[model samples]
Target: MTLFIGFLIGCAFGAILFLGGATSYRRILGTLLLKDLWIIKLMATAIGVGTIGIYALDFVGLANLSVKPVYIGGVALGGLIFGIGWAVSGYCPGTCVVGSAEGKTDAMATLAGGLVGALLFALAIPLLSGALIEPLSFGAVTMPDLLGISGIWLALPFGAALLMVAFVILRERAS
Candidate 1:
């Protein structure tokens, strides 16, 4: 019953992802080209809100930071590489899966490439541990932590940033 429930949840999540255009190659490509940053902005803002909410919950003793130390260098390098590869390939993991379901040959290639890449990364963990690692911000360490200000104080700047991004998107859309 537990396994069946998990399967159903995963199926539901996949359905939502597909319906949300979360797997749309064109939308992903638009982000890279800067032709349409709406999807990118939406994702960024949503993630920001999620991060703040999670931290707030953790502070209230309702949640925990359940992640380990992050490697900053690896993250930066990975993001750079991933962005380039994603732009060139025209599909990401989720999109690739959805496209594969729709019988796309290129999406199949993307999925195969992702599998092989993951396998290679797993095999290279030992070599990468020392060579590519760097100190990363972990825990609920946010601007408030570093600046010694209450989180509520930092919300203003965050709101300003979001507003600026929204303005940029609006201008882009208008022109």
Candidate 2:
């Protein structure tokens, strides 16, 4: 049942990506080149809504929130790799999935490469965890904990900030 629910959600999200032109390599490149702002707006909107919705669920006692330990080195390295992939391929993981669904050969290749990378990472974890993950661990810091405030307090300001940023980006693009 859980897998079914996840599958349905994934399908819906993929459909949304396809319908939004997010699956297009050209659109992704345009976003990177700042010639198009749709993808940025879409991502910003998703982040904003997800932030608010997650917090709202928690506030209403409908969700249990958990924060993973923050490994600074791991995050930095992973982000660098991810940035490289996005810049080179113009397809982030979600977009890659959407493109693959649409039968794009390049996206299929990207997805295969991602799967191989994930497999290699998993295989290397035991060997790399000590040097790459644990030493820089900044244990489970949540915004509420860092700010010394309630989750709602932090979430409202953060969500608002994201929305404001998204609006500014769209407004600038419009001009």
lDDT of 1 by residue, 1-175 (tens): 8699768866765575566566676666666677776666555555556556656766678765565556777778889877776777887776787777777798899889989988999999788877676345454445666898766466656755765565564546621
The lDDT values for all models are 0.68, 0.84
RMSD of candidate 2 to true structure, Å? 1.8
Give the least accurate 10-residue stretch of model 1, judged by summed lDDT: 134-143
- Kindly give the stretch of ten consecutive residues in candidate 2 with the minimal lDDT sum: 166-175
Q: Largest TM-score belongs to which candidate?
A: 2
- Model 1 TM-score is 0.64
In angstroms, give how far residue 83 of model 1 lies from its true place: 2.2
Whole-model alpha-carbon lDDT for candidate 2: 0.84
